[model samples]
Target: MSDHPILFLPGPTEVDAELREIMARPLIGHRSAGFVDDVQQVCQRLKWLYQTSQHAVFESAPATALMEAAFRNLVRPGGRTLHLVCGAFSERWSKIATDCGRKPELLTVPWGMAHDAASLRQKLASSPTFEAVCITHNETSTGVIEPLQELAAVVRDASPSTLILADVVTSLAGAPLNFDAFGLDLAFAGTQKCLALPPGIATYALSHRALERARSIEGRGYLLDFVRAVPETEAGKTLATPCVPLLWALRAQLDRIATEGLARRFARHIAMQHETLAFMHQWQIEPFVADSAARSPTISCLKASGRDVRQLAENATKAGYKIDQGYGDLKGKTFRIGHMGDHTVARLQKMLAALLR
Candidate 1:
């Protein structure tokens, strides 16, 4: 295991040794009583992590699967979905809606800018036919954090019938998200980023509104259908066979997170964000998201200026550290540094020092 390089880019951030050990434990039957008990316990912790009392379910697939599930289960055929697009992930949600046969309208801002709540309100007022609103709480591609609570409030007032679906794949554990209080219909996050686990499991909290919406939508697929999962969940099990190893890892990781306390965990991420940004400013390299208020504390996307960011990442990797040169269209123009999960200030400082050299 020592031969494997540590991950620092984003999603699959470094997992702690203790959690890894849990993943290597003996396999258990998915339908066994022990497994059912384990799932229930993990679901409870997930609710606490999301800061919601809503029903939380674990998906065996990655975060993208849950995103698709949200679109499929919430939006009926020929229904309309309004997607707030500012980065790659948000754009993906628009595509997902289209693929699900729903007509999707995009309210777009530039890559680095946030989709302001007022602008969303304006769009909602003009287009009241939308069945749902999809927002990426944190865009991993651009390191932008949307104002989830404010946007939710606007959507609630503008169209009470339109369900609000948020993707918090990269932001959940590292930041604060109140699913129920914010009036969100559904919110999903993968375990890899802030949960400090592997990449197989994605957890989601579903409000009663989302479930009611699903009840009205016909032809909702079986695997991801929330309507199906909710009934099986009541029996303390998944509708399908879940990844047992990932669940073990998730249980262990959630225990570790609970031990650290959510506020302190969020603070640690903020500290790393500030430390990395401060170091980048010394080199005259500004962050991709110009407004600090819109920046993500878990992931920092740094504009490369005139520097060859790809080459910088290659060099940094050779120095026993792993990093990313942004994503999609921003690949060469920006570089990203992730400080979520078990990453520490000293570790981030060392990577920054190496890059600054």
Candidate 2:
């Protein structure tokens, strides 16, 4: 029916038709009263979604930009930050920190595995005081969801002063993350994933402690300066012109999420996860992540089981679907099915049925 196949990759999930229409409406001035009100409302809703009382703000950039901003704002030059690397996204954060000219120490587990709290505790004990600890809540490439709540507790007990920075790009909205309750200093995500919106914007929640840290850190750049964004964000304005259409689409999507209720939305995602697992079993393929506890409810990575994953993806595209063959080093060895955002169990069942055919 359409030239472009429906997306079932890890990110840039399918958008609702209603939201597309909303984005197409006439543009609005970023500084106008109506736009300001929209910005305020969106932030408030985001706090509800993140389950945090901390300050939430957005920038006209991708999630990686926010990752770099976190390093610039929280870690001083030559200050050490610990990165927990288990997959591509987590490894990317460490590189971003190094690119910022900060000292980063990495604690890596094998790919397709979760970082253990015990190992993290031991690592923190052996290392000097860190300025921050970077974690990827959900590894999109590996389809692993680390035990964030437990890991945060380990950080609190072992290194109370260290800021806990989380990249929740593929986990937000589709997973259970209570920022303030879990004691996170910073959590960031791109809307193109679970928020069911288009790319080009990223949102983050910053605690009071993080703001204080940003105030103390020098050389924080102009565009992504966390300290500079506060005053304007508090007054319901952005530092510069934002992608206005995405905000309009975001507001509408938030309303849809509100109607569904956060708990229900999370339950829906879990259901999709189970459905996908059943589909995997039917095909006699196993999940990449062996531990059921660590498997992501948003994306499922399955071992190829002697199948041609690249050709499978090509067939899927020809059949009007776009599926992930794998990511980075795992390509052709494993494939991923993104079941987050507005996708439901019924919809996933239909897709799985088609694949079966």
Model 2 local distance difference test score: 0.90
Query: Which is the leading candidate under TM-score?
Result: 2
Candidate 1 to truth, TM: 0.97
Model 2 alpha-carbon drift over 4 Å, by segment: 1-4
The CA lDDT at 185 in model 2 is: 94
lDDT (C-alpha, whole model) for all candidates = 0.88, 0.90
Best by lDDT: 2
Candidate 2 local lDDT, 76-140, one digit each (tens): 98899999999999998999899999999999999999999999999999998999999999999
* TM-scores for every candidate against the unseen true structure: 0.97, 0.98
Would you give me the overall lDDT of model 1? Answer: 0.88
Quote the positional error of residue 161 for candidate 1 in Å. Answer: 1.2
Weakest 10 consecutive residues of candidate 2 by summed lDDT: 348-357
